[model samples]
Target: MFDLRMWFRALQIIPRLSKDEWDRLDLVSRWLIATRAAVFVMTIVSAGIGGILAARDGHFSGLNFLACLIGLVFAHATNNLVNDLTDHLQGVDEGNYFRAQYGPQPLEHGLMSVRDVLRYTAITGAIALAAGVWLVAATGTAALGLMLAGVVFVLFYTWPLKHIGLGEPTVLLVWGPLMVGGTYLCTAGQWSWDAALIGTAYALGPTAVLFGKHTDKLPADRAKGIFTLPVLLGEPLARRCVTVMLVLQLLAVVTLVWRGALGWPLLVVLAALPLLRDTAAVFARPRPETCPPGFPKHIWPTYLVAYAFRYNRRFGLLFLLGLLIDLALR
Candidate 1:
C-alpha cells in the first residue's frame, strides 16, 4: 500500500539518506515535506484572516479568497524549488554534503541529477506563476505586483545577487515579512498595519536564525567566493549583528502593543522557550562545526511555528491573536 511504503520511506530518510548520498526520493521527499508544511501554514494564515475579515465586514468573498490562498501556497512552494536549482547551479554547494549543508543535502551527494531537479523546478514554478496570474486576474494590479515580486525574489535569492552576499537580507525581506505580510494584504484587501507588523515580526525571528546559520559557515562560504554578511563583515561583528536582530524582534512586540496591533496576550512570544535555547546556542558556536545549526534547523522554523500558536495552529498565529484583539476592542 502507498501508506505502508510512505511510512517505510519516511523512516528510512532519518538514518539512510541523512548520511548516505542523495537520491531522487531523498530530494523529492525533503522538497515535499517543506512544501507541505509551507502550504499548510500559509493556507491557515490566509484562510483565518480571510474568515475574520469576512465575519466583520459582511462582504466576505469566499471562493475568490480560497483560490487566492491556494495560489499563494503554489507560489511559495515553487519559490523553494527555484532556490534549490539556483544553489545547485552555483558551486556554493559543491557536492560535499558534509561541508555545506542545509535545506536539501541530496543535491551535493550526486543522489539526484541537476537536470531532473531543474526540470521539476520549472514545472512547479510555472504552476505557481499561473496561480499568481490567477490572483492578479481576481484582485487586479496590487496582487499582480506582489506576486511578481515574490517570484523574482525567490528565484534570485540564490542567483546573481547571492553571489554578492545579499542572501541574508534577501531572505529577511522576502522570506520573512514580505511573504507573510503580502499574503495578509492579498486576503484582507487594503493594507492593515497590524498585518504588516505582525508579518515583519513573523519574518524577523526566522531570519535571525537563518542568518546565524549561514554565518556559521562563513569560513567555507568565503573560500568559495560567496559573500554572506559574516564573510563581508567578519565573525565577531556578525555575532553582534545577531544580537541586534533579536533585540529588533523584541522591539517589534512592543511596537505592536503600542499601535493596538497586538493584544496583551501577545506576550505569549515568551513561549518561545526553544528560541531561548537557540539564543544560548547562537552565543556558543557549534562544536562539530564552528557555528551553530541553531537558527536554520531549530530557530527559523520555531519562530514560524510559534507565530502560528495563537490562532489556527498554522502560520501567523501570534499575529492573529493580535489581530483578534484589535478587532475585539475596536
Candidate 2:
C-alpha cells in the first residue's frame, strides 16, 4: 500500500481528495500531500546550485551538501504545514476559500485535526532542526546564524509576512540568499556574495509563483484581510508585477554572464526566454472566468499560478543544468 503513484502525483500538484480517499492513502502520500511537496523541487534546485558551485570552487563536502539538501526540504515542508494551520486558525481559509478549492487542506477539508497537523509540524521541524544543528556544529557560527534566520522566516512567514506585503519578497530572500548562499556556506565553509547574487535569479521563479497564486486568489485574500502583495497591488498591477519579475530573472542571469562571473555555458539558460515570454503572455491578461479549452479542469481556479509553476520549473532546471555544464567545462 505504498501507493507510489499517489506519491508521484502529490509531488507534482496538490491532489484534491475526499476524507475517505485521504484515509486510504499511505503515510508517504499523506505526508507529501500535507506538506505540498510539489514546490520542493525549487528548494532542490537551489541546493543543487549551491552544491555545484561549491564543487566548482573545490570546496564541496558530499556529507554537508546532502545534509543541507535534506534540511532545506524538511524546512520547506514544515513551513507549508505551518502555513495551512495558521491560516485555518485565523479563519482565512473558511467557506471553501481559494486554498481549499485547489488542494486538500487537511484541516479545512476535514481530513485532519489541528492536533494532527501540529504533530506533523513538530516532527518535520525537529528533523530540519537536527540537520541545522549538525551543520552549525560542523561549520561554526555562520551556519548557526543562517539557521536562525531560516527559523524566523519559517515560523512567521504566514502570519505577519503574508498578511502584509512582505511575503513575496521574503520568498525571494529565503530561497536565494538564505537557502542557496547558506548551502554554499555550509558546503564550502565560506560566504560568497556571488553565490547569493546568482541565486536571486533562480529565486525570482518561486517568487513569481507566489505572486501568481496570490493574484489568482486576490479577491478571496482581500476579503479575508490578507494583504498579500497582489491584493495590495490590484489584479492588473499584480499580474504585471509577476511579468516583470519573470523578465528580471532572465536579466539577472545575463548580467552575471556578462560580468564574467559565469562561463559561456551558463548562457544556455537564455533558452528559457520563450518560456518567460509565454508566462508573461499569460500574466498580461486576467484569469479567465472558466477553465479554457484543453486546460485541466481540476486546476481551473489556479490559472496564473499553474502557468507560473510551469515556467519556474523549466527555468530553474535549465539554470541548474547550465550551472552544472559550466562547472564541468571549467
Candidate 3:
C-alpha cells in the first residue's frame, strides 16, 4: 500500500527513513525525499513571481507558465540529486558530513546506490530539458539562450561553483534573474528588467537560506578543504552577510514601490517583518553545537538553515500574495 502519510511528510520535511522504511516508500516518495522536495517550494515561488509579473505586464500564456514551473522544479530537483552524488563520490559526505546529518544523502547514506541515483538524475534532468526545449520552441531564440544558461548553472554548480565560494551567489542569480527572468521571457516572449529586479528581491530569501546552510557547515567544510562562502568569510562575518541580504530584500521592495513598478499591496510583505527580525536574530549569533530549547528535535544538526527556511517560506508567500493583489488591482 502507498503510504500517503510518508508521502506528505517527505513533502514537508526530509524524513530520516530507516532501511526498511526506505524500501517501503513508493518511487514518487523516494524521488521526493532524494530531491529535497521540501525546499522545492522556493523554486515554485520564483516561477510564480515570474509568471505573475508577466501576467501583470499583459503577456501571459498558460502553456508557457506551466512549462516554466515544471522546468524549474525539475531543474532544482536535478541539482539536488547532483549535489548529493557529487559529494558522495568525492567523499565529502563521508564521516557523518553535515549534509547527511541534516538530511538523507541518498548515495552516502546507502539509501540509494550510485546507479540508482544516476538514473534518477538522468530522468529528472531529461524532463527539465524537454520542458526547456518545448519552451524554446514556443518562445524562440531568446528562450533557447536562457535554457542554455540554466543548464550551465545546473551542471557546474555543485562541483566548481560551490567549491569556489560562488554557490551562494549562484543561488541568487539562478533563483532571481535566471529562473524568474527566464520565466518571464518564456511566458511573455520578451525581456523585462523590472521582472528581473523584482525577482531579485525574492531571490534574497533563498540566498539567505544557502548562506545559513553554508554558515552552519563552515567548520566541517573547512576541515574537509571545502571553500564555501562561509568557510571563506568565517562564520561570524558570513552570518552578518545573511543579515545584510535580508535588509536588502526589504529595501528592494520599498525601492520598487517608490519606482511605481509595484503598488501599495506589495508593501504587505512588510507583514513578514517579525519573521525576518527573528531570523536576523538567529543569524546574529553562532550556531549552537547542541540543540537549543524549543528547536524541532527532528531537525537537529540544522540550525541557521532551518530558521532561514522558515523566514523564506513566510516572506515568499507574502510576497507572492502581494504580487497577486497588485495584479488584481492593475
Candidates in order, TM-scores: namely 0.73, 0.98, 0.98
* Residue 194 miss distance in model 3 (angstroms): 0.5
RMSD of each: 5.7, 0.9, 0.9
Cα lDDT tens digits for candidate 3, 199-275: 88899989999999998888999999889999999989999999999889998998999999878899998998998
lDDT of 1 at 41: 55
User: Per-prediction count of colliding residue pairs?
Assistant: 4, 0, 0
Q: Give the TM-score of candidate 3.
A: 0.98
Model 3 residue 62 CA deviation in Å: 0.3
Any residue pairs clashing in model 1, and if so which?
22-111, 165-227, 307-317, 308-317
Name the regions of candidate 3 deviating beyond 4 angstroms.
Answer: none
lDDT of each: 0.55, 0.92, 0.91
- Give the clash total for candidate 2: 0
TM-score of 1: 0.73
